[model samples]
Target: MAGIAIDGISMVYTLPGGGEVHALNDVSIDVDQGEIVSILGPSGCGKTTLLNIIAGFLSPTAGEVRMGGTRVEGPGAERGMVFQQGALFEWLTVARNVAFGPRMAGSPVAEATEKVERLLTTVGLQGFGDKPVYQLSGGMQQRVALARCLANDPDVILMDEPLGALDALTREKMQNLVLKLWKDTGKTILLITHSVEEALFLGERLIVMAPRPGRIEREFRLPFPEQALSQPAREVKAGPDFVATREEVLSMIWNMEEEIMGQAEADQG
Candidate 1:
């Protein structure tokens, strides 16, 4: 079990013409072990940028990331990333895709096979392992993605809208799976989503961000996720607390988005 500490992280992008765009500004957050956190914000709010930084795929221009009390200089097996798309290899079977990490790490064949089978079963794809990646539906592909990440037994799972491309029904089902995985595996999770409902449903702590020099704007520690554990997702979502929190977050994001649009118009004018 490990916690992630992101201290004073910021990102600055230099455009081709010598203009500087600040993508993140002094963003800091802590995710404790076995806890789930979700980041919710409008497009261009640096949510993905933040996730990438934590994944060590991008180096923040300033500050550092630490996990389990050690500095994170680059990508490692302890940190797994799930992108919007499954990003699975079309040529590989589902089982091979899930086993790739363990196999590459030099685990013996039997051990890797057992790990793959367990992960497939965990992700609700026990029999689908023999199926090619191209044969699965969007939801199933995302399940494979989650299973592949788990195969590495990463201490922290970073998800970037892993369910964004799915239909409404599928997305709801995936949300339940994520919550179940979190409770069962006790792995720290940081999910980036555009849905307020998803954020509230999956995150014990929710962060809302603002763009144009993206930074954390608001955060809520809510009980909706824990509530969802005992109740059906739909029922939990319909609860008063969920509805109230959803409205509050939506209103804040909408106001921030309006401010962004107004600033853009003024700059053009």
Candidate 2:
């Protein structure tokens, strides 16, 4: 029930030589409770940086971030993160990995065990719970990662290219799964992705960023995802609106890339 507020955030990374690299500049975004937002951009556009700032993994050099109006100073259980790769403990079984969060939070053994079962079922990994993480397929591993995040019952989910590593078929499958989870749980989700198709399919709102002092350059309120909810994802994606939106976003990003290259050339000249 908590929304996120990012106000004028800027991040500057100081190199060993004292040179400063401004990764983000005055980037601001708001994610309402239970809303799903996706971010897209070319490489080095600070998409991940903004997600990190929201997750409280990195403090902004300027401005502040708040979750449900409380300032975000550092990592907390209210926000759960899913990375590009399933970073599950290779040594632990899928069930254990899912149970880890609850146990760590001091939930009773019975309670955590029941929660793990429910989460595993939620992620479609019910029977695979006892399997070692190393044995599961790449897609299944990601499922475990999702289950683990959900087990914590976090108010917000931060996914950094969560489907980027999967094969095309698997990625598409996971896209629907993400939508299902978002609708079923009603938790706020902020996704960072490189695929315009994926973003269009999953995001109720889409944000596009530009690099070299990365910032949000464009945003769209998309109807495709909501449409996909009632229709098949493939049908929705193939619709005229979806295709048109994808092209517009692609052109926008392509222009941003050209601008970045132009700036670099001028700097060298």
Best candidate, TM-score-wise?
1
For residue 135, model 1's alpha carbon misses the true position, in angstroms, by 0.6
State the C-alpha lDDT per candidate. 0.93, 0.91
lDDT at residue 153 of model 2 (Cα atoms)? 92
Query: Model 2: residues >4 Å from true position, as ranges?
Result: none
Steric clash pairs (candidate 2): none
Taking the tens digit of each residue's C-alpha lDDT, what string does model 1 give over 1-269?
Answer: 79999999999999999999999999999999999999999999999999999999899999999998899989999999898894888899999999888888999999989988888899899888899999999999999999999999999999999999999999999999999999999999999999989999999999999998989998899898788889899999998889988999999999998999999999999
lDDT of predicted model 1: 0.93
lDDT of 2 by residue, 1-269 (tens): 79999999999999999999999999988889999999999999999989988888899999999887799999999999998884899999999999988888888999999989988888898888789999988899889889999999999999999999999999999999999999999999999999999988888999999898798888899998788789999999889999999999999989988998999999999
Clashes of each: 0, 0
Work out how many backbone clashes candidate 2 has. Answer: 0
**TM-score of each candidate?**
0.98, 0.97
